[model samples]
Target: MMKVHNRPQNRCFFLFFHRNGQNIGFAMPVIFSSEDGKCFIMEFCIYPEFRGNGTGKECARALLHWAREHGALYAELNYGGDERRCHFWESVGFVENGSDAWGEPLMILPPTEDVPITVEILSDPEDWQLMKLENGFKREIGENALTGEKQKQLQQAVKQGKITFFIARRGYRAVGMCSAAKCYSTFSCWDTAVFEDFYIEPVFRGKGIARKLAKAAQTWCAENGMSSLTVCCAPCDENMYQSLGFDVRLGTTFAHLE
Candidate 1:
């Protein structure tokens, strides 16, 4: 059944379609009033099988007509993350903006070969210290450091089977740290840092410590059923990461509200 939240004076309609005994699609239309007049249409979706059959365009046109009848001057729908739906929305007169609302560049990486690395799960206090030292390199690059609270949260996540952390070391000195987290259907290499402090420590630098650490994380991710691994870094660090065989892909804009 279609769930429609309707207000007498200012209303929005949610359309749901069912066919052949299967629930297939739904849409949400939002109405807004401003000085420029009223605007409508917030979101829409259709199952893949039901798409491209004129259902979406017809529904959009009907929604627009309803909005205009209710005194709306403009109707808009966003295709921000749905590349497949761009043409469908555009066919109904929606225009693409060069920038997303947050104005961040979008990037994507398809499945690729996972590069192997050797890593050890840190279990000792000394290992933690080494991990901290490795994280300092990220700080130097203006990357955010994992806070104490976050570390604790990650520890809990690890215990709860959400992620795993690996530390690469030479003798007793920790040289690198990598952490991978499971995100629903995929695993993400959350953090991989090789410390400058260890870079000049004579025994850790120039010895593939970073590579080993990365491989260890990859191994853990694979062992836990992740078919691929992904990580992101500053644009300038792309080369360094790519040299390790990470298929570099641009990422979406990152923004924070103050």
Candidate 2:
């Protein structure tokens, strides 16, 4: 790991990891303001020697903090379909908004805020209390979603704090539910929160309730001191999260090494 410092003179900063004694990587973070808000313009690159060493990710976090401190409403950047590059940015909290004229990936970090919904984090979620979650997963995946394996294992994991279950209610009925978990990123060495099991009743689908629930989940994570919040969304679900100020996981795919 390399130490971070401020270079207010040039509107940029320095990072040294692979070649500490020399000027290894230079990341000049810029923020531009618009009538609506401000966008963080990230002008940066890493030396070949420091490419895979998480140098870019660290610089990104530092820049975002700078933007937040400067009252930036959002952060934006443009990228291409480079899987490695895309992964690094997404894992660091940048999502693709759209492409520029050159077909590059445009990414942004929207400000996080609460929604107009009443939600709570359950400390002890029993089997009976999991009815909404079970049904929601079944509806999204299939009816036999729980036929093979019991959900008790996951329930215990929630109890152990590996996951936190959130439920949104109208009066007394649970209308929406989301499962938030802690995601540890060894690259940035921070816990990035993720929303895994997010579902809202079909009747409540178009009422902006989903976004409210999402915000509630994020609020919980932020209160717990998480650096960023991420949601694994499908193509059809992209617009919803985007409307709620979340970035689309462009050019990103998941894989597990055995």
Maximum-lDDT candidate: 2
List runs of model 2 lying over 4 Å from the truth.
1-117, 147-149, 248-250
The residue pairs in collision within model 2 are: 79-105
Question: Which candidate gets the maximum TM-score versus the true structure?
Answer: 2
- Residues 91-168 of candidate 1: C-alpha lDDT, one tens digit per residue: 776654222123211111111223233457756433354435434444444555566675566556657755556666
Q: Which 10 consecutive residues of model 1 have the lowest summed lDDT?
A: 104-113
Each model's TM-score, in the order given? 0.40, 0.50
- Residue-by-residue lDDT tens digits, candidate 2, 40-153: 364567777666666677766776776677666666676655777677778987765433323344565644533345677765656343554555456456454443235667
lDDT of each: 0.53, 0.62
In model 1, which regions exceed 4 Å deviation? Answer: 1-118, 124-127, 143-151, 186-203, 248-258
RMSD to native, candidate 1: 20.2
Please list all clashing residue pairs in model 1, or write none if there are none.
Answer: 104-253, 116-215, 117-215, 117-216, 118-212, 118-216
Whole-model lDDT, candidate 1? 0.53
